[model samples]
Target: MIRRHDVTPAQFAALAAGYGGPETIEALARAQLSKHLLLIKFIAEAWVGARAHRDAAVETLTRAQAAAPAEVAELLGSPLVGAWAADCTRRLRGGLRAEIPLDAECNHLSAIAAAAAALAGVEARLEVPSFGGRVAVPGFGLTKLDGAAVATVACGRVTVAGAAQWLAPRTLSATSHGRSIRVTLDDVDPYRGGHHVPPTGRLTSVDGWQAVFAEAWDLLATHAPARADELAAGLRTLIPLQQVDSHSARSATIRDAFGAFGLTMPSRATDLAVTLVHEFQHSKLSGLLDVTRLSDPGATELHFAPWRIDPRPVSGLLQGVYAFLGIADLWRRLLPVVAEAPQEYAVVREQVRWGLTSLEGSGALTEAGRRFTSGMRAVFDDMAADRVPPELVRRAERKLRGTHDAWQRRHQTTDSPARP
Candidate 1:
């Protein structure tokens, strides 16, 4: 269906900014720092939509993607494009409609609207594909029939078992470049057993942790509601994770605790803040991307997003990721300075260096290399400019510089074991 619409400057920027070379969601976030919430909503919807109508949407978008640029350009003014984008995102990130029965007609409306907005001068040849297969949720444990996800808008309305059983409503969305996506789980029980774990080693009471959360909240709340909301909303996602334990994660570099099985309590503010921000970024970032026309390629043969039945070239997703690295790395550099056990500065440096190695290998980093450096430096600059506290910023910067220099010396020495 073709409908008339108009694209805005902001939407145009989002389309351009979402590419991260390899880190789509992170890049998308950096591109829309000014409109973080919008970015979040966009990415989340895209991911979940994709999850819901994996094959149909992918097939639709692939056909749409293959359309002549002249026609694709027309989609900018077509209301159908936005509707499609919204639907695919839902399938990709939200639990698949097969199990949830989401109201994906919502996407038809959205794709049309966004198409009108994102493709202004271009007329898009749009097609709404029919969903007709099993679907899976990207991160959540759920599934549904082709149309069931949209049908069960009320599916997540209530939970029967423990807090773990509680379900939430959310629309997955992301920027066109896939910088990141957001999943807004609805009807959340803020106080739940999932978030209620016995404070572990080094943890005294919830009161102590609450004080830290309060301070972080105070700092976050002082900013835009968008910032506060993302901060709060991001935290809410972690509540159900076996990894609320993730908050206690400490890392010299990768914060692997959250990524794998690790149990430890946070002993430093920087560690706590960085861990929260990183996981938050991951949760949100993962929401917006179109990983495949199926569920985790690692886990299933099913596509999560609606896409054509073919190898969908995610050529741009990684491009988007490089941009995300610039942002995530900056935050990592700015986290805090604490000489806690296993959280040594040297360890962090090796981690950063190891990370840079990945960037170096990616080649996009070569083009975006300068931008990456500038972004890293910006962390300290923000602290000096008072966007962050001087004390926290200063220590973090020192740690980073120390790490960088050590990394350099190691490379100069034996190319092994990273210099001491």
Candidate 2:
């Protein structure tokens, strides 16, 4: 479990009053911060004790989730409780942390009982559940596929049966027993991150993602003729080659970001596409290290997207993030053949068509141009020679030529000595 601090009673009462609204978020956060926080709050509030806190506290938590990600509903203490509150609102039997990290990168899961042991200042290891590729064991028939832990949180019991919601670019899943709840999430962004994706089909060694990539790319090519240029530009940046996933573009959160990547899609397809793009971008960027930084981490950053602020001025930082999103968006929009390649999987075909219709016109993503234009130019040199439109290709060139004038106008560094 990721360790954290505690919360105070006064803090709990102060923030608990505002449970489910954006009034405080709107006022406290910048426009960019506010937009992403809305999504964070939506998912976070759905997790266990979120409902107990005041709207302000939840809003504060949401903001922290987005900007101060290092501190989500961590072990911060709230005096009103016996021990400390993981969150101001999440008052467990004794206000303790329930999450435990299972893997090196903190991508695995462990039970709460174990977490409490460590939290009680006992420093014990928790026994976590296991499911690797839903294998057919000696006695068992079938099981879950292999993947990292996608959801982990603490709370009083919530819904009986775990309700899975894949709203797109956003998702919410909460399972409660009696007094506690475990709500896992992705996000719904004005310009938000798509996260916590489930497997669409499978990506084992044999019937792996590589095959899925070629087929999905071909299918998407037919519908998104306008995106072809963007697609080609993105493809040229990859290192080894693009490898798409089985049941390509079938993840839950990706559904909402279909339009942003320039794809006309249904819900399910969009979801899968969104995730595939993210993974694919990661793969490709690794291939293109010499290419540019316009491309960033598709896996680490996008895999668990927190929330995105939507302020116009903050677009500069947003631009850095959008560059990667643009690549994933393209990947999602372009992969549709997982369904048709019956030669590989028949059910996948049906699922693809079904999802495309479900996630229609969810949202359009702006090209995070400011940051990537340079990166794009650097990596796509092949396109640079002829693939890129002349005017577009000349962009960085012009900027470089006018560097002196630009520096005089915008450089903020001071040359004068400081006076005490």
Candidate 3:
């Protein structure tokens, strides 16, 4: 059965303000679950309509749901599953062929069912997709069977013929001031791609990743407890990407895959914390956009975003504004404790201020989007008022001007105006 999710006016305002509490995060999660459920239903119906092979995976999933409703629901709510379902539906809708055989793609449902059955302690036999001799049980670990494609789940154990290796799921944790954050280091799922980078299959060792994640969590919990609580509630899966350099990492969030971050390993805990907060803000806005109409579906206008090299659409501009708003708040809270916070806050405050200006002038925003931007403006106004050293403030202004000039020069030949 499909469930209806709603955001009250007060909840909407709080979320738009960029500091929605944990409860709002939970509500957004529920809304995402509902969306995933609808997508799964669409996939099933489309497959049947196409006269595709009928697999027993759906039946197995139904059995698991009956036996352990809560556990099964949690498994189905996984972001990887959401990604798979969305991709399959899109391919089917567009009459596009999947990279894998349709039957193999259909078997992904079986893998999900097998994982659910194992969680529920139900015996089940199913043939799941195998990628390069690896079978990934969604929401769990991966089992390598060299050439095997079928998986058997019995007594809460997953096994396949000629199994040669097993990699348990990795998770990292950190706590401070009676608050803790735990997240799965998901490096094994085949469908974990589309996070803006190819998934790095499995890590040789998670020790380094664990240390950095723990330090990052501690930083958030100690200084930004509210954001920490939000992380504990909303951040679930971290998809590791290949590091770009010793000091830099690339990270992105998928609109369809809420609660999952695809990121390279950061050398510093501060970088990791900021990345988590920034990506999670994107996730929150994505979820809100799902339930509400924030922008006109037909409106098309590009605007200058100080953070990006090219002009961005109104929707993209709004996303940047919201993300930097969170970063600005993070640095604002860390100002007294961390020496670099003032400089960091000044930089993001300027970027966000520029983005908000672009968004406010955009003709693409719906009434709800306008209200949301206003809430963000109120938050930014507070952060902008924070006293930074005169030198740092001057530095930020100079940087903004330099970026704007560079952007204008780059887009001068284009039809769209360089500034909003």
Candidate 4:
């Protein structure tokens, strides 16, 4: 566990620099702080306007506090921290909601609970019943903890199942196409939902994530073999997954934390394969950014994003470009594999072009961003140089350009237009 005395700014920076690779003790300490401090900020934010949920939130915080050493607890409870949390929460509320989202509230609260359990030298298993008519156990099997807690917080109930005998987390290992990965079903991400507090309903399915993961791996092996190896090498853990139950689309791909990847069980191997590549891109960039800040801290102007409804900051633009670098590569490889599906191929081709154009327009990246992007540009150009059907290129360029132009007119700041 990371005690307050063990962490220094230099150590934290080193950890960020290492990203998620095998790190020394100091780097590991920094990783823990990076993950937990986010949760702590959320907790402090939720404490205000907790109103009806005050007891649950306070209980969650108190338990976490009691579990940690005095120094850690003081850091968590500092008045400055509370004030900061309040300010952040107010901004997050955006005048639309009175309090933080329920799932976020529960997610952070459970993070606190999990930390408390870890500090007490015990392993925890969670059972969360969502109001949405399903129950979920993110870390089902009894497993050793990684100096952190596993907790389930919902309106229904959040309890510690029992202790794991092992001292490290439980893992599932699989190999395919001569590549292997260790999938960790542990409590690593503190801000995940599906394990929520009461009054919410979620459809949580158990006993099937392994099959989905295996299938996804096979698809990668067959189609994008090289990227699969990169994934296997870069990825060390996989968090618990849930079923997608959205109204618009029945599937979702999420990369919430720097290294943590989550997916709604995908039916199509191709879908899963693309998601793996997409989220892996985020993980890689997150690790890189930890070591280096790629933009001025004061660069907070929101800009139009082709993929989003709301304006995004320079950081978000950089992240999008970095992530799409891999996405574009994945599609470039899969293009030949899905040749039979002409319509699908068209979309994939457009994605490649769109990704390239977005990277070209990715504005004013910091020195680090420019350095990283220079390498990305090399690969992107290599892919771009590949000859494609001229008709396909024309069609895709038109479609992608139309999408970007339409999005700007609708979403970009009109009071002061964005640079072309």
Candidate 5:
């Protein structure tokens, strides 16, 4: 049976104020997991009725479920599994073309079942997907095979014939002041593709990632304990993106793939911390959106966003406001300690203020959206009283106006300014 998920008024307010506790995150996760499971069920039923020859995979998964229900459920709960299932469902529904052969596409479930059986110590042999001599076991690592597409699980061991190497799952962990953060450095999953950029194929050494993540976690745990806790509870995987440059990094979060983000390696831990807080805000809001609709879907009005050169829809504006609110909060906590905190705080806080102003005047907000924005306004009002240097505030205002003028000149329109 599928479970119905609801967000209470208080929880909605807390989440809107950018303060979702672990419990709230877990609730969102449960809702996402349910959506994935329903997709899987729909795919299975459709495949069976159409005689898609997917029974072997279904049988394997059923046996695994009977032997170890929790293990099977856990395997299915992965974000990549959801991505794969969503892809398969789309293909079956004619929304997407069949890129791979139907049988090969359906075999991903067999791969998942094989992983679950291996985890549960159930003996089984199954045909799974092999890409360039590597067979990935979801939730685990990859096993290198010469040319085999079959996986055999016996006596608590999973092996592909003539396998020469095993790449165990790698994770980065750090602990500071009783707070701990651990996340998988996932570079092997083929389904980790929704984040615009492809994953950086398996890393030779995770030493660099480990050191950077530790430093980043220390900063977060020491200063932003609330976000640290949120990360600890919700974040599961980090797909490494190709490095763009020494000082800058790009990151993104997909709406369907909860708890995972694609991020390039940044040179400084401070940048990584800021990126983490910023991207995870997107993740939180994405998860919340899955359970509830905050904006009118039919609304088409576009407004200037302080961070972007182009106009954004009301939904995009809401997402930016929530994300930059977290960024501003992080910088606010780092003030006077980090060398760049003062200017960063002033800039982002001004951006947040600009976004909130636009959002308040937007006519596209639904009832829920209005309440959510009201909660955000309350938080911003509280933070508005926090002191920033007079010089920095002036500089921020100048930059804001300069950006607005540039946008106007480029777009060739004089819409109302996004600022007060």
Candidate 6:
């Protein structure tokens, strides 16, 4: 097991400042805590809403049951919490109409209860049963989902059963980049719930993903060791890496969660390496945002996003810039490593130039957005002076700006700003 260290705010600030170095495992672990806390906080909010409705229901039930004293009171006493919890689960499910399993429902409530107890800053002596209950949040402490002692906030402890230990039936460890991380072959996402869900695609069997993961890691370790090392240092887990059998490679990266999200492993190692670095950046920023807010909370208006075909909110725009920082950084570094592969080198070089151009058109950010992005300012500025042909740089700039303008013309609304 890796030794856990206390991650400081200053460390996160430096990351937000855009310093180039491998992200310490401790820091990544802290960011993971922020994600769990945020998820817990969300459930707590839902629980509070559910309780409001439940209290009224309970009062009405009590009045009706008053006709029969002993039997009715016993019924009420036993099922009160369970009934309220069920109602809260329904409310939390929202408009999604699907047959949710009973275990899933109970687990959902348990998660919320844990979060609520933590938020209340009180001791939670609740034992929650779950498929895999592992709530290990850095600084906040560890909780197991399985055992009777599910959570103890007073002592900062949580016990999660199946979920924590069950990444995949088949798992492997790879530390080629100087740090160890678990690669899971399962297709089911452990973090699936809330607004997050599994993506649609052909699932890669254990054997398929294992082979793909091997190829991907080999490429990273060989061609982009530095980038690989950075990822190893920061990304401690990979899970439910399902394969999408598509004609072309495609991937999705989510912040606030570790591991790839239905991310397709590309055929080319270079592509895989670049994709890993790109998505990992999103994961890093998500963790950072858990502790620090970059965009104004009130800036809810959607705006044109250069990288995306659709208009995005302030949060999306900020995420785009931050993610592109890593994208550019990867290609900038890889360009030198792939010198022998002229075709690949040229592609990396263009990607770096285009990423910079895209970042520039990312529109106006809030004060925090600007400050947070300041850390990356030097990196982008350095890439600006790269020896790429002036025409290639100009072409990339025009293409990116043109795409943004076109998207705005097609989708911009009265409330939507001209730029993000």
Best by lDDT: 5
Q: Which order, best to worst by TM-score?
A: 3, 5, 6, 4, 1, 2
- Angstrom error at residue 230, model 1: 7.8
> For each candidate, what TM-score against the reference?
0.32, 0.22, 0.95, 0.57, 0.93, 0.61
Residues 162-207 of candidate 3 have per-residue lDDT tens digits of: 7767686788888888998778898888777785557786798999
Error of 1 at 261 (Å): 17
lDDT of 4 at 321: 61
Taking the tens digit of each residue's C-alpha lDDT, what string does model 1 give over 163-240? 123123233222222123233221121111112242122212344444454444443333223333444332222222
How does candidate 5 fare on TM-score? 0.93
lDDT of prediction 4: 0.49
lDDT of model 6 at position 51: 56
Better of 1 and 5 by lDDT: 5
Off by over 4 Å in 5: 48-53, 144-148, 245-247
Model 4, span 246-303: residue lDDT tens: 4321222232233345455566666667677777667655545545566776765665
| Tens-place lDDT digits, model 5, residues 154-239 | 77677777776767668999999999888888888877766655668778999988998999999999999999999999888888
Give lDDT per model, in order. 0.32, 0.26, 0.82, 0.49, 0.83, 0.49
Q: What is the lDDT, from 0 to 100, of the residue 317 in candidate 2?
A: 28
Ranking by lDDT: 5, 3, 4, 6, 1, 2
Per-residue lDDT over 174-263 for candidate 6, one digit per residue giving the tens place of the 0 to 100 score: 655454556433233333322223443224445655566666677677666765666655554343433444575666554434543335
In candidate 2, what are the lDDT values of residues 1-420, reduced to their tens digit? Answer: 122222233322222221112232212112222223333333344434223222333433333344434322222210001011112123222343333211210111122222222233232222223334222111011234344222222232111112233222211121112111111121121112223432222112322223334334444445433333233322211111122344433222222221122111223433333443443333222222212222233312111011222212222222323334333234333335333222212222222222221112112212322223333323323221323234432553443324423433444423111110
lDDT of 3 at 95: 62
Off by over 4 Å in 2: 1-271, 278-376, 380-420
**Best candidate, TM-score-wise?**
3
TM-score of structure candidate 6 = 0.61
